[model samples]
Target: MPESLEKHGVSVLVLDADGTPIATVQDALDLLVSASYEGAELVAVPAGRFDDSFYDLSSGLAGEVLQKLANYRLRLAVFGDISRHLRASKALPDLVRELNRGRDVWFVTDLDELDARLSG
Candidate 1:
């Protein structure tokens, strides 16, 4: 496991794939607290096997998660090949395209791409 940023007193969080979920909202909040405690400047959520629950990307739960991140002024990046999302929802694809043009949220294909986004 990666060392916790809490040990270094840096406000940064690297949320693993398991962090995404309708039921894990509390867990996600806890992570935000942990990140805050660590003095995190950025919180990263890497691409991985997302739970099937996330398939309902249009659901209020997903929006709630996004709202939470926005409320905290955290940059939210979902990294990985989301061709599945593109195949799943036409609206989602459009949303991804739109959000990609913004700085707050990014739908990236890889970590390198995510790094470029964060740096640029």
Candidate 2:
């Protein structure tokens, strides 16, 4: 589990299969809250490669996660290529674009971009 918050002074939690983020949306939210409580300005979630056999984005997990973040007033920065989502659903691209333009959500391609966004 490679989880740490150290990208341009922003708090980051990288979640892979080895970590606890795969369990549930609440688990991920808890982690973010914990980080925020510890004075983290931003949270980066790099969860890529969804398991086709078990996980599905259309199951409302994304909305649940976003709702939780909004409730907490925490900005979420998702890093990595989400081409699969764009290919699966056309709405995802627009959603990402809109979120990036918003105040609390961002879909970034690299740490540099994330850093720039968080900084500016």
Candidate 3:
């Protein structure tokens, strides 16, 4: 299930943690269409909604999905602790750090952090 809400004046579509994993660019495009139809500027997908490949940079799943979303000009907030994935990958932490510096994509630990980032 997904919920619609407003945070920091941004209309958001929040996806449930338990759902079909977003495993490909097509899945990401579907989400973008859904968010646009819902009148949302952002889609807040729980971290668990992604497949393991999404955390593996070499797999290129993250780039494909993120690029799809960015092409549609839709913001994404992948919220939850992905510490284990971060620890396993040498490049991911730095990638996430840089990504967090922008407004298009974010990897946040929780809703509060998501709200703060959106507000900022």
Candidate 4:
């Protein structure tokens, strides 16, 4: 599926197509390219876009994907409540907390929150 573009406040962002799971590094690369093609500075992705292994830090999928996005200087706004994953793993919550504190990555509860962050 192709990426979808949306306006969040004044900022335009690319969103992952529904049902597309970013399961590997290649997926991250594709997402970056799509975002670039859409002329978006950020990408709003649902937590469900990630594969199960992404929550399993040991699999390194999450870190690898984040690295790719960082290298491309793209911002990622993960929009969803990942409370279940936080409960399932001790490390993920801390990692998410740190990421949310940074400029490049943000774990947001919803699109409106992401839009607020983009605007404010």
Task: Name the candidate that leads on TM-score.
Answer: 3
Residue-pair clash count for candidate 3: 0
- Looking at candidate 3, the ten consecutive residues that score lowest on lDDT are 25-34
The CA-based lDDT of model 1 is what?
Answer: 0.63
Residues 15-82, model 4: lDDT tens digits? 64486788989988988888888777778888888888988999999889988888888888888878
For every model shown, the clashing-pair count is 6, 0, 0, 0
RMSD of 2: 3.3
Q: Model 1 compared with the native: what TM-score? A: 0.75
Off by over 4 Å in 4: 1-11
lDDT of candidate model 2 versus the reference: 0.66
TM-score for each model: 0.75, 0.74, 0.96, 0.87
lDDT for residue 5 in candidate 1, whole number 0-100: 37
RMSD to true structure for each model, in Å: 3.9, 3.3, 0.8, 2.2
lDDT of each: 0.63, 0.66, 0.91, 0.81
In model 3, which residue pairs have backbone atoms overlapping below 3 Å? Answer: none
In candidate 4, the residue pairs with backbone N, CA or C atoms under 3 Å apart (3 or more residues apart, or in different chains) clash, namely none
Q: Write the per-residue lDDT of candidate 2 for residues 1-120, one digit (tens) a residue.
A: 546667756666554435454345767567666766666656666646333311244777677777877877777777777777677776677788888888688888877788788678
